[model samples]
Target: MAGFLLILSLFIAPLGLSQEKVETIVNKLPERPWAVVEFVRGKVLFNGAKVLKGEKLRVDGSLEVSKRSFVKVKINGWDNTIVLGPRSAMELKLSAQKTGDISPAKYSLVKGACRWVRKKIEGQVEKGLGAVHTPNAAMGVRGTDFYLKVNPLLGETEIIVFDGEVEFTNELEVTDKKSLTSGQWGGVGGRYGQKIGEILNLSKAVLDKFGKKLNI
Candidate 1:
């Protein structure tokens, strides 16, 4: 019996040591910020308080841009950037998966317009960098530069892809989706059973107008 007990103790010792090593490694892991504010123009509020340049933003944070104001934020580690246009409100959320890996930066646009530009890193995959959810639609990024606008009152969302591609789907019906590429535009309406509109070529005039609005 004493020999059996000694054997059991020996077997348990490595398990405890392994657990301690794991805890030590986890504790030593560095904490990373979710995003950082790179620029601010006019009046901008983060979580109901005024925002300042170089501020670090965490998950579950909110941003509101007053009329004629703009704010620019860069996702830490990912190098992706988001710019909010006037009268825009957006919320940031983290994915359950680990950051800088399979996890994609998630955002919910409550209203107004915003632009997203994904920085292309050499040898990095172009997709799964970020996603945006609007009232009427959802967009999956593929290393793209795009502009999105939401009209809360009308329950509508407009999307224009300047470069790369965006996978757009109707929030109401996931099956109703389309891939928008450069020079393409689409939209979704919030009415009952509303679906994503047909993909259309964006005229240069429309691009100019949107560029002015987004200040891209």
Candidate 2:
């Protein structure tokens, strides 16, 4: 009975965390947070401070997660969410147009892994403006769900597109772009990137992991 109770407590602890569903807006440059940390675990840091649940993320700031930690945030003014994986460092830049609707999200993943999710815009499809920059390549995403990981030792960027498509391009060549559809994944490094093959289908275990991390 004691062992069972301990296991149940471990699973139930995270359920008690506050998951805020509200949106945050930034009217101008250097304004309030463009997003807020919806959930956090272990040692997550935002702009040098220890990140707390519900902490606002500044557009000009950066985030770092220690080993065994993760942080999820909801982007304001845009339909997207970002999950920073353990041992990762990321910087966020969000620009807003005069109409108050922000431009597509931009992120720089300096180290480690992260997941990106973009909700469908009002009428846009097939094309997206969100971009993520890694050491080896850049990714242009439409309304899609994707995962990216930067190998610190190999200097390679791994990408997996769960929904929609992502345009992967080598940072050295702006014209080089490869589109990866749902269930497709590949790697980018040394000035080139290629799609390996489609995954056919994602297992329930994989879906559950992403769903829990991003809260899609």
Candidate 3:
């Protein structure tokens, strides 16, 4: 009986962890398009510590694991955009288009999750300011319609082929590094091993959903 109980305990522990779902928007948010920062507690901090449009809420500091915090910020000038996941972080920078340059438009996603819809990105040296260099892989962000997902906890990164081609680099390979065409995906094993996962065909519905220019 003792040996049987030990085996069951191991299985039950993982199930308990998998069952816990991360909490969703806990605080009352202000009106849309305004800078809204939320805490783990049911309270929110509105426009510079002042309650402009949202309900008056005390700044709750419960932003650990039991709770989560996120901020929504937007700028008017730059035509660039970024999207993030839950409990994720990222930094954004944009370069204005020059007169005669091939791609004066450049965007850099330093960390976390971001979706970039580029106008014209065609060179490696033409990356906005600094490039996104993860622990194991490097991407020459040629202008394309795509997004990057890097898990902060797992230190794993996945580059999904949305549209256009992206040049990928790591450590081991037979020929030169490969570019991910549309509807394909690749994984980085953190040890210079490029594991090719899958290639998918675009059905009519899948094409309609991702092919059109939809708002983020």
- Top-lDDT candidate index: 1
Q: lDDT of all the models against the reference? A: 0.80, 0.70, 0.42
lDDT of 2: 0.70
Q: What is the TM-score of each predicted model, taking all chains together?
A: 0.82, 0.69, 0.44
lDDT of 1 by residue, 24-139 (tens): 54455544438788889999998888999998877567899999899999887777788999899998875445554345667999999899988677897665656799976899
Candidate 2, residue 94: how far the Cα is off, in Å: 3.1
Superposition error at 48 for model 3 (Å) = 13
For candidate 1, the 10 contiguous residues with the lowest summed lDDT are 24-33
> In candidate 2, what are the lDDT values of residues 1-216, reduced to their tens digit?
356445655665576632121111111323232788888989988778898988776557788999988899887656678898889999877653322233555688998988898888776644344578887678885688888888867667877777877877767666666777777666766332342222335566665565454343
The lDDT-based order of candidates, best leading, equals 1, 2, 3
Clashes of each: 0, 0, 1
TM-score of 1: 0.82
lDDT of 3: 0.42
Which of candidates 1 and 3 is the stronger one according to TM-score?
Answer: 1
Kindly report which residue pairs in candidate 1 clash with one another: none
Task: Give a tens-digit lDDT track for model 3, residues 1-216.
Answer: 356445555666665632222111111222112112221232223323432222322222211111143333322222333333344444322233333322232223334554444445344443432244444455565555555656545555666657666666553342435577776556564432344334345566665564442224
Deviation (Å) of 158 in candidate 1: 0.6
